[model samples]
Target: MSDPVIICCAITGSVPRKSDNPAVPVTVAEQIESSHEAFEAGASIIHAHVRNDDETPTSDPDRFAALKEGLERHCPGVIVQLSTGGRSGAGRERGGMIPLRPDMCSLSVGSNNFPTRVYENPPDLVDWLSAEMAAHGVVPEIECFDLSHLFQAAALHADGRLPQRPYCQFVMGVRNAMPADRVAFDAMLTTKRHLFGDAPWCAAGIGRHQLELNEWAIAAGGHART
Candidate 1:
């Protein structure tokens, strides 16, 4: 088999207190600059979110469009994957950003609570978004917060809501989500069990679990970048 592909950077995510990482980009320029840095580091694909002027997250179509224009201008052929599960707005509200026609976008296969609030995604909403995305020619990278998310992914595929060659990102180590272990191999196994054999998969662990799971995902015949 050919070597698994590598995703270059996760880029600037939505959450994470500014105090934690001053490098987290919050504005248009910052997001683009960070994308450039990550692209140069050998990342051909990026998982991205748009932030407001004050460093808060927003899924504005204009903002997403701007990023698309800028990234394509500077780095052509770099796949910019937009995060549909934006932090601030309602998940459905965030869907408005789809007009930008990103090469790839996220699809949260399940929901879970994070610290203060709940991240909500349901079947109807998922089905609607998946259909809309297909019409727009956008690829969905199913985001899995836990094992159950995998089930949802299967169901979506079975129902013909999602296209084949499903792409999933196993986000382990969040508070209520799967724990991120220091053992890379263990993390890989946990992901593999849910993903089945040889599906296009990526793993991430927040906070202290980040590096461990990331490295583990990369070594375990999966691609790792952000």
Candidate 2:
């Protein structure tokens, strides 16, 4: 296929720490440096999450602004997608960075079981985040952690809550959430095709399933998140 694949580099996640790998970018400077490297390495998008001095995740917009500025200066046309995931913040605070007007931001349409607890994305919060994204002209990358989420995205799109063409990302291998199964992956593709037709989509696999899911998504003609 001649279609260009958009590679998204998640510089640092909320859960992983320096203690986990010693290479996780914690500070804003470190995140910028890592994002620059990823941009140079052919990643067209930077999936970012800001952390405090204590290496804990925060929803501080200032930190996101610094990271966004650095990425725009260093990476130029690279897409900056800030994480609105629950681990970074709670309630509306999770979308505090939306006003910064990043190129894109992740939006989880529904809740699912995380490793230890529920990754809650209530209807109200999801709607609020969607509105924030719309107000800021920031595109929402719908994170689908379960089959129901795909339908939820469809409903949101139908109601004009999500103005964009619903860019969904399937997240697999989380403890009590979806697993990295080939059959399930194919089913998701089928459902996406039936619901959204040829609209662009992506996938991410947590922990050990990352590379496997990347390959699977690429081979299936979908974007892969690394």
Candidate 3:
């Protein structure tokens, strides 16, 4: 029997805009349509970030609700994962949509340097987000931008904060964060295995390394995110 691979599609990120590609969905309606297309193309998970009418990212729960509603109506059983990412909001505002109770949400357990600024996920905020996820029954997709984050996830799980063996996603090639290197990828896999044996995880490569990471992850018998 073939191993079943779960494909996760990030419909619209907070940083990209329609101006960047004319195809980047800025409105909720466009995002729902894009998600439906990806679902038809075999994506079982939809990772989304809501936006304002002016194309700026927002942590508006209303917008999240509308998008969640549309995705449920159009895509049925596909998992809907909302972004509690920093670009969309600051502090607790990022997790404001957690109450909407999507199947999962992105949780950054540590801070890392981005291209121009610090992607600050302070310990207190991380604790808050984790607590919120626990309260609302939202599973967290641990976004590990650096190697320390992998350990952090393990610690969180051990302490009962994460509740489950984490479904970690190694995020690579993000400017000042961990780069897209084969050695680093191998180390991540090794640590994941040590921490959670045979558990499912995923990898994501930014910019030009995206397809490469996808191939590497698949060959390694893990999951890939595009």
lDDT of 2 by residue, 120-184 (tens): 99999999999999999999999999998999999999999999889999999898999999998
Residue pairs that clash (backbone atoms under 3 angstroms), model 1: 8-43
lDDT of 1 by residue, 26-142 (tens): 777777888888788778897888878777788888888888888887777899888888485675776876767888888886778876767787767888788878878899888
* Candidate order by decreasing lDDT: 3, 2, 1
TM-score head-to-head 1 vs 3, winner: 3
How high a TM-score does candidate 2 get?
0.99
Would you list the C-alpha lDDT of every candidate in the order shown? 0.76, 0.94, 0.94
- TM-score on alpha carbons, each prediction: 0.89, 0.99, 0.98
Q: What would the C-alpha RMSD of candidate 3 be, to one decimal place?
A: 0.9
lDDT of 3 at 126: 94
Q: How much lDDT does candidate 2 score?
A: 0.94
Error of 2 at 156 (Å): 0.3
Residue 181 shift from truth in candidate 3, angstroms: 0.6
lDDT of 3: 0.94
- Clash number for model 1? 1
Candidate 1 lDDT trough over 10 residues, lowest sum? 181-190
